[model samples]
Target: MFSADALIQTSGNIVGGTAGAFLGGYFAIKVMRTQIEFQRKQNQQEKEEQYEKTYWLMKLVFEGLGSSIDDFQKTMNKPDIDDKKDYPYLIGLLKGTLSVSKEKKELINDNYIPKDIYREYLAGITLFNSCEFIIERWYQTLHLDNFKISTDNYQFKDLIVYGNGMRHIFNEIESIKPIKKKVTTTGGGAK
Candidate 1:
């Protein structure tokens, strides 16, 4: 038979063991939670940086393309449109606008755009289907074949699609308005 003191000591040892097990389990869970939170924060930061990079690249491409288009349009609207001799000048202007940098030219010849701006422009042209044919020809001239749309930047993709769609619809409506105006003017002239 066990003495009272021995029984008490055994009970004390069992209680101490239970408490240690509980504390150990609790601390393990706490450490795991902290690690998970850290990982999540790191992933979020990476995604934000990727988005910023993509946005800036798209902005550069848009600026370059917009400047070129404005220049071309201005040249086309000149009063010398009837002069057949001016055709070569127009072609020269287009060639100059479309010409890439030496580094980009080399990359194109090797079948790529070494910079993100050209990649975004290629992707944007595809997403904006209304301008695809013209942009496709331009892309082909550059020999840039690896243009892939990044789904990592879903918000940017959505913005591009929405903005392009709105612009296209607006253009169609504006075009119809001009046609209506012309018809009304002709009818009034006949009257």
Candidate 2:
């Protein structure tokens, strides 16, 4: 038979072991939860950064195109109206502008762009096309739609179009727009 003191000692040891096990398990769970939360936050931050970079890249492209259009308009407005026969010179200027824009587009596609963002790039192209279309329309209205001469209104319209598209993209990425909640109608009764 065990002595009373021995029995008390054994009981104390068992109690201590149970308490230690509980604390160890609790700490392990807490640490795991903390690690998971950290990872989630890190992922969110990375996504936001990627979005910002892509937005800025597209914005740069828009600005560049806007500036080129402005320059073209200025060139067209030169006082030397008799020199309007300079087709080769105008073609060279147009080609140079296109080349620069293409290079910028390639740069954006190469850097700070992921395969998943290809759709966004395609949308950017669509936005560019819309800007060009609007400019063409304005040109047509002013009878300056010919490829030879650029008009002030057309250039301004181009810039405005580009700016609007940039704003739209930014708004989309930032989620500034309110989410529409679906209303469920029960028996045509207003709730």
Best by TM-score: 2
Report the Cα lDDT for candidate 1: 0.46
User: What's each prediction's TM-score?
Assistant: 0.50, 0.54
Candidate 2 stretches greater than 4 Å from native: 1-10, 79-94, 106-123, 129-147, 150-191
| Predicted structure with the largest lDDT when compared to the true one | 2
Candidate 2 whole-model C-alpha lDDT, 0 to 1: 0.59
Query: In candidate 2, what are the lDDT values of residues 75-144, reduced to their tens digit?
Result: 6567774333653454455445545655666655335455554555666677766655654444444334
- Candidate 1: lDDT of 186? 38
Each model's lDDT comes to: 0.46, 0.59
Expressed as tens digits, the lDDT of each residue in 7-45 for candidate 1 is: 999999999999999999999999999999999999866
